[model samples]
Target: MRRIVAALGASLLAACSTPPPPERGPAPAPAASPPAMAPAAPGALLQREAAVWRAARWDELPGWEADALQHAWPALLAGCARPAPGWEPSCASARALDSPDANRVRAWLQQRLQPWRVEAAAGRSDVRAEGLLTGYFEPQVQASRKRSAAYAVPLHTPPADLATRKPWYSRSEIERLPAAQAALRGREIAWLADPLELLMLQVQGSGRLRITEADGSVKTVRVAYAGSNDQPYRSVARWLVERGAFTLEQASWPAIRTWARANPAQVPELLASNPRYVFFREEPLPDPTIGPNGAQGVALTPGRSIAVDRRAVPYGTPVWIDSTEPQPWSPTPPPPRPLQRLVMAQDTGSAITGAPRADYFWGWGEGAEDFAGRMKQPLRMWVLWPLAHTPGDAKPISTR
Candidate 1:
């Protein structure tokens, strides 16, 4: 689950867990950790390209003390690998922290960070804190090196002339034309059985392939984003809604898959409805437990990494997000589960454009995919900046 760049243009991934489930029993007394920088006090209102930030006390953040931040420790450390401007001092101190205790981590953060409530810029009017939260996941699909009855669809590397042509062939043209097919001939990295899964992989921008090689050895590899055909992206989910296949509220991935099964003949047409096509290049997977690299160039932590607009929140910043888990649309929908917790801003997405918007990273697997697919919830966020620097002194880290 990297910086997917779009929620509707391309779906962001999400998952079920948040901050490793709070530590059981009462919180212990703060334990001593490595020395940190002298805490600088927080400041007042600040403005960014599309957001407004108001300095706030930690108590203002919901579940601030309740979250077991030890689970978020890995993500914090990961972000430090490429610390943003004004983050060097904090990152240095963070690297010295060895304890995984909830109280200890909490104390470290409180000592060195300032919480700022994020609000959307409302064009010379008041600021609004509420924003959208979506989820993204790294899809894991079974694949084969060679085409077979079970694995017929091909996932390819970039075509030879992919860059020569601006806005290359549409997905429908690629599937329907021989010249387009010829350009991709013998370029297949692996073949998959379910076209829908392949489409999901493309939409998600990256995936894990459990590939059976031609020599009969099987290994899991990551198929990362190489390039796209540069076509305009259209949402298949929206297309389904327009065609009366499912209502807007019911257009989740599961529902789409169900509709595909019932109307097998229409599956191709349904998939082709989204003209955008993505290409991939496989990478070696040495660590299965670790997640895919985000836009920050660090491996994502399950339930801990988030995709945010760089304009509002810088990469590597710790964010305290207050939101509820995805709720069903049915009459008997379950109670709203609180999704408040500490997360790292390590990625960004295309649809993740304003100050309040975010795409939660759910890591990988079927459970992640399912949860991420259904995650479209209201979000409120607070960015934790290093207390040592004022908002005026801190600059957003450039990914370009």
Candidate 2:
């Protein structure tokens, strides 16, 4: 019945599956051990998550999203031993390197990356022309001497690119969606943001997204995308209803679109009002806890996917991203051979799981962040294990 809402959930649904198994039954009531530290509050949890994501200078550092996903996807995939359907239980399979999950995912992703006309006709997800904006992220670049962390640089674009706001949906991999590309042909979606492979629609660029800590220290972040490839307008309106925005009748796509268009300048205001929209991306473990690791993580140059083996690929491990998006996205040139790196798969979302299935971090820039939210396509990944395999790497924790 609904189109966009389904579109919105499509991405996230692929990453996180149903809530994780309830802690293997609560640790047998903790055996009356010494009292543990108080758990984090929802707000606090979110704040902590935000603070962790903000690298030295700019909030939307290139590989931050990748780092975040690197933190959580493995666990989720390890947990999702079997893939199921329906909202009740999360659906995912342990796609080990060269496993069936790997095969299916890679094959599907291969089709997705192809020309829109060929694959667009095949039902998959969807994309539409939108605006673009400059995305910025500071990595540790070289200087007079050795390596060091540096502030983010301005990866620029005009405001119009960050202003265009429409998600184009393709039909099923078996059938075309909305089949409106012809009407919407040649539409350029200058979409950008910190994508985690799913739900990229709502995170539209509005205001400055800053990560503030308890002590009042702040790291201001400029997101990249006008990311609206989220769930349908109705879904957002429904979420709004949950947050006391409107009545059921008003929670329709038409109503929401009209309202969104009417209050164009206020979209950020409306979006910010919904707490559901206020989400925190999580990073993988052994996070270096903000030490001066200056971890060299990978950069998600547009149209690319990085790999991670939770046990193997440590977070903040910067690696060069490799993709065949041809020119435009990738200037200079790609290596004669595939170049892979250990990026800081720092964050995690509800959807991203499986060993091969990766979270293409879209960083926190306005446009980039929005674009990252609604991305729900299967991605192929080749986790770059160390060139010189270590003893411990041999017996990697069973991601089965």
Candidate 3:
């Protein structure tokens, strides 16, 4: 499958200032009859349905006053570098503020933005704006510069002629075919131990690799989404579930590893079930604090960056998420706590297709992985846009 590649950088400001107005000419005469209703422009209607956007008061946004807005400051600023339409004014104002104070940032947002509640399209009795919320994170894996007995699996880079072919080669073909093997002979970026871990990294699109160098010096580097063969993606876990190896609820990284250990002979067949293959490129870790590039071309914030459907919520827009922690699937799940907070629509994913769906970024390492792996719960969202911004002819029901 072809994965999207995004650029990362830091360059955003807070929305504490106002933009200059556009120069206008003399007012025109009133229309003799009400103007005919015009067709909506591109990206006007949310999801091309009757999705109602009820304007909300600031107080209606749950936990708005208590959230630590400073955490999302970096993500907002990075998005400002490539501000979207209807967002340029707010981005410009934000560029002028340098302070990272949470109170000041929260105040600026309250002053300039109008929050709208996303509702299901009218007449669709079965639909509701509320949908599933999940999480994804950058995983850290151990690797080596040279292919050793311990680290036998190799992570390949895109070949010189990768773009020339429509679908390069399937994962099985690459391992079995001579021509496919030749194409990736010298394109190894790094070697890893577990094939399952490498596949997980590819599925997530990006991750951090902890490598031991030739001289025994260890260093950490980012392996971001470079490109992939255009084959379709299939879930091996789903395959396991269908085969009765485990139930859907019991499917996870640890469970999969246990299955692999029990059925060592089926490892190759399990991997070959999915035809898609991903190639990666190493990136420099300039600022260890920042994360890999998101679809909006900005560095993601640990708790404040979320992947949203671009058609429903435009990139660079502020989104308020009201959800609960996912229920644990084991001996005991974590207590269901409120996950209300402010986050930015700074990324996107193929699976995130609807308006209410979102994938929260939880940063990197084990803690993030643990949370991200289990985050699948119901979600409600409120989009904060510039007060003057309007999607189409839809007027705000109320304003704060």
Instruction: State which candidate has the highest lDDT.
Output: 1
Model 3 error, position 368 (Å): 1.3
Q: Give the lowest summed-lDDT range of ten residues in model 1.
A: 15-24
Model 3 over residues 198-281: C-alpha lDDT tens digits?
A: 877776668889998989899999887777777876667767878998766665556678999999999999989878787888
Tens digits of lDDT, candidate 1, 1-400: 3422123212522211111111122222243343355532344666787787777888889988789899999899888777777677677777777776899899888888888888886754566889888888888899999899999999998999988998999999999999999999999999999998888887776789999999999999998777778776567787777788876666577778899999999998987877778888888999899887777777788799888877888878999999988766786898889999999998765456787888888888757876777778888999998776755533342223
lDDT value for model 2: 0.26
lDDT of 2 by residue, 69-122 (tens): 333334333222221111011111113323334344333222221111001111
Candidate 2 lDDT at 312 equals: 28
Name the 10 consecutive residues with the lowest summed lDDT in model 2: 45-54
Is 1 or 2 the stronger prediction by lDDT?
A: 1
Q: Please report the TM-score between candidate 1 and the true structure.
A: 0.86
Off by over 4 Å in 1: 1-43, 390-400
- Candidate 3 residue pairs in backbone clash: 12-77, 13-94, 14-94
Identify the runs in model 2 with alpha carbons over 4 angstroms from their true place. 1-344, 364-374, 390-400
Task: List per-prediction Cα lDDT, in the order shown.
Answer: 0.76, 0.26, 0.69
TM-score of 3: 0.81
lDDT of candidate model 1 versus the reference: 0.76
